[model samples]
Target chain A: MGARRETILETIQQYVDLVATGSSADVVALYADGATVEDPVGSEVRTTREQIAEFYGALDGLEQSARLLHTRIAGNEAAFAFELVTKAGEQTYTLAPIDVMTFDDDGRILSMRAFWSGEDMLVS
Target chain B: MGARRETILETIQQYVDLVATGSSADVVALYADGATVEDPVGSEVRTTREQIAEFYGALDGLEQSARLLHTRIAGNEAAFAFELVTKAGEQTYTLAPIDVMTFDDDGRILSMRAFWSGEDMLVS
Candidate 1:
């Protein structure tokens, strides 16, 4: 009954798609102005748009595909697990991160925390 | 350098197993003295031993089975997806709730927040 869950779910899917195929700005657009992003949980949190954009910019020219595995949405927060396979020259890496996010009334992400560490990554 | 992820993982598995086969006291033992539990994100949070015991009392004397599906552990926090199947006489209810939790240094659960609503439940 907070933010529309349908809209939030749609936004999550859009986020995953953007992370896979869209630019850094496209991915950052899903977040509100003061939103914070902490990728891999224990890492330093990125607060500024430039920092967040740079974090996502790492995927700009990478060959990657993302697939959402499980999602649980309640109230104004959602935790979803997605698998990302990325190719860097001759190496392929796969990482599945479960992201917890809080959304604003308009379905813009307020904060995003990813639950995964380097040990969870698989290189092939 | 907080709580060991392996220990926390084992504790989570123990929790799911106890919720399926043990009593309320068994489940409550996993929590710290001032732990908080919010079974569903929007619901009221339960604190104190008596209140927490009362919350888990609902699972008592019911035919149930639980299986953990996905887990992501980072630092002293973990987010896991689990499947719970309960049978009330001729009716069967299945719910898959993704639970996010933080653990203390001793691996005791400090806070447990489940992300699932009645809409996510299935009856057969």
Candidate 2:
């Protein structure tokens, strides 16, 4: 269980690192095959490893950062609440981001579901 | 376990109903003693039952609504993902709200922690 917790932490750290460094490939590599991401309104976009990489690369200068508020783990899954903010040119924006992650027995992320404000992002 | 799940669901439904009906005292009655509510930045405000009632009264017609996206239960606990929106006259707001609930053996809410954006509310 300790190892599982550590792996979950490492997975989150790696995701953050990829965001900070603008490494789309590295970020996509963290997801398990057949993973699906959902927006706060329940719409989801499912993708494979390569598609996730392309999705990340499609954005330009997407500098995003988040402060994790809490993480609760139960068995092979974890739920995280975070305050996410982004910057593009002269505009700054903020949103509430919650990530639900499911890890396989080996501790790799088997699924990742993200919840965020799409309307806020669109208007911002 | 099924009874437990039903009780948990009803708790959440009652919360939503309180918000829509603007019944501050009704909402406060749902919390257990020593309940804590945390913002996305991790700052928490702990209040007793009467204090929670007063807190609700402090707001003027605070109309809020939420759509449950998904709910996952583990034993006596549950985690819910919801899309929360609020309307104050001419203004509209949306948030990604995640609720973590711990229930006592009696099926009453022992604790509830809410995650939302403080900055967005301030700015809006």
DockQ winner among the candidates?
A: 1
Question: On a 0 to 100 scale, what is the lDDT of residue A21 in model 1?
Answer: 87
Writing each residue's lDDT as its tens digit, candidate 2 over B1-124 gives 4336668778877776675565776777777666655334244455576655676675447667767765555445666766657777888777655676667665567766554444224214
TM-score of each: 0.97, 0.49
User: For all the models shown, what interface RMSD does each have?
Assistant: 0.9, 10.8
Q: Summing lDDT over every window of 10 consecutive residues in candidate 2 chain A, give the lowest-scoring window.
A: A115-124
Provide the DockQ value for model 1: 0.82
Error of 2 at B111 (Å): 18
Model 2: per-residue lDDT, tens digit, A1-124?
Answer: 4336668767776665565555677777777777655434235465566656666675436777756665555456667755567778888777655577777666677776664434334225
Name the lDDT of candidate 1.
0.92
Cα lDDT computed for each candidate against the true fold = 0.92, 0.61
Stretches > 4 Å off in candidate 2? A1-3, A119-124, B1-124
Question: What is the alpha-carbon lDDT for the whole of candidate 2?
Answer: 0.61
**Candidate 2 docking: what grade?**
incorrect
